[model samples]
Target: MPKKIAAGNWKMNGTRASLPDAMAIAATPAGDCAVVLCPPATLLSQMGTEGLALGGQYCHPNASGTHTGDISAPMLADAGATYCITGHSERRADHGESDADVCAQTEAAWSAGLVAILCIGETLAQREAGETLAVLTAQLNGSLPNGATAENTVIAYEPVWAIGTGKVASPDQVAEVHDALRAQVGPEMSLLYGGSVKAGNAAELFALENVNGGLVGGASLKAADFAPIITALAAS
Candidate 1:
């Protein structure tokens, strides 16, 4: 079976004042699940809590370079991060990152001994046109680098329209995508559902076949909001 994980992407949020929430989350018992917190780069080093894993929101494809202000996978590892997110929709859309770029970043994460949480998803328009599976499959094939394994990589499907929008894919939608991903990646690879996941709907989502965990957003900012989701995943 794949490892059950409850990962929180704090995004471009958090500060010294927000450290307490991370601490509180780390204090929560995760049962059989592993809890990871990917805070903003500013807090990744400081968020080395004992029970929770630390990760970087993004990383440069280069190990070390003249790319000013860009953090590399090696740099994240040096700062105590054991995992790094690559190909997040926001990065793909906002920064115009191509699938080739994401594949390079995934390889960089592997070189630095960090697990790459590769994200893939479709926009609402794509979903509306019934092209969700094709889109996801293309992104997965394009963004995932060669030599990826269950141990070194995780797949997160967060629909572009649902992220931070209080919209979530239905259980049927999640099952279809996750099932397809599982077929392609094999049974051992962990698959996570993201986008508007909260305590209210976590259990149902986690209960679905092929859903190993979740990649949370806003709810992750506070332990009070995120802990319940972890507990739900543990139960699943």
Candidate 2:
């Protein structure tokens, strides 16, 4: 079975005070999905090793220092991070990361042996214009590294409109896109859905064909909300 995924993107949230949740989730029995947590770079090592695997919020394209604010992929790996999110919507919108930038970051990720959670999504205007798939295709085509593989690539489709917007794509709509992406990347690739993946709709979403797992945001902050979503992902 393709390991079901339950990944958390901590974004700008979490502090040294937030260590407890990682501990709890690590202890929870994961059924089928390979669970992961991407906290701020400050917490990766402190988050521990036994059960929880670590991830990084973002990583620089180069492997060396002097970039100042940027964290390199090798640094992430050194911190014990197993995965790292690149090209997140926030990075695209806030920093204006071009497709080439995302591709560079993707390559750097593999160089450091960290799986890249490559995020690509369309805004509401694009979705309304019936450009959803085309936008995704273009982003995938431009951002994916030439040496992509299932072991190191995980695509996250986080509708820019729904992220932190309390809105989620219906199961059917999400499935339509995920299935399309599967054909694009081949069966071995894992297509993950993000954007307000709360406990309430997780099981409904998980039931859909090709709906492997989630890249949770706000809901992942609290074990109360994140736990139920993890429970829902257990293979039926």
Candidate 3:
């Protein structure tokens, strides 16, 4: 059976003051689930590792070199980042990153021996045009490096229209995409649904046939918001 992962992408959030919540969540996470917290660069090493695995928001394609403001995979590994988020929508939008870039980053993560959370999604316009699965298929093929494994890669399906928009794909819709993705990735690779995932809707969402867990955004910032969702995933 494929394992469900309740992974939190802190994004550009988190600071010294917010570190305790991460520690707290790890200390008393719900269920026998795998959990990971991706904090910003500054606190990767300083954060305690009681109940969660730490991850990095992004990592440079190269293991090391002179890339200003870029974090290498090995550097993140050394700083205790067990996982990293690569090819997120924000990166694609903000940096104009192409599929090749994501593939290279995935390779870098593998080289550093860190699990990579590979994100793929379709935008609102794409979805409206009935291009959701097609877009996802293209992105999945282009973004992920070849030979990704259960040990080194986890795929996140975050519909761009739903993220932070207060709009979520219905549980059925989520299952369709997730099940297709699961088939695409084989039985071992973990496939997660993400987007405005909240406590109120988490249980229903997770109960879908292929819905595994979540890769939350705003809801992840507060313990109150995330904890219940975590519990819901466990109960599912």
Best by TM-score: 1
Candidate 3 RMSD computed on C-alpha atoms after optimal superposition onto the true structure: 1.0
lDDT of candidate 1 at residue 76, scale 0 to 100 = 97
Q: What is the C-alpha lDDT of each candidate?
A: 0.96, 0.88, 0.87
Scored by lDDT, model 1 comes in at: 0.96
* Per-residue lDDT over 75-146 for candidate 3, one digit per residue giving the tens place of the 0 to 100 score: 999999889999899999999989999999999998998999999999999988999999999999999887
* Best-fitting candidate, scored by lDDT: 1
lDDT of 2 by residue, 148-210 (tens): 988999999999998999999877779878988989998887778998998889888888778
Q: Which ten residues in a row have the lowest lDDT in candidate 3?
A: 23-32
**Clashing residue pairs in candidate 2, if any?**
4-33
Better of 1 and 2 by TM-score: 1
Show model 2 residue runs off by greater than 4 Å: none
Please provide the root mean square deviation of candidate 2 (C-alpha atoms, Å): 1.0
**Against the true structure, what is each candidate's TM-score?**
0.99, 0.97, 0.97
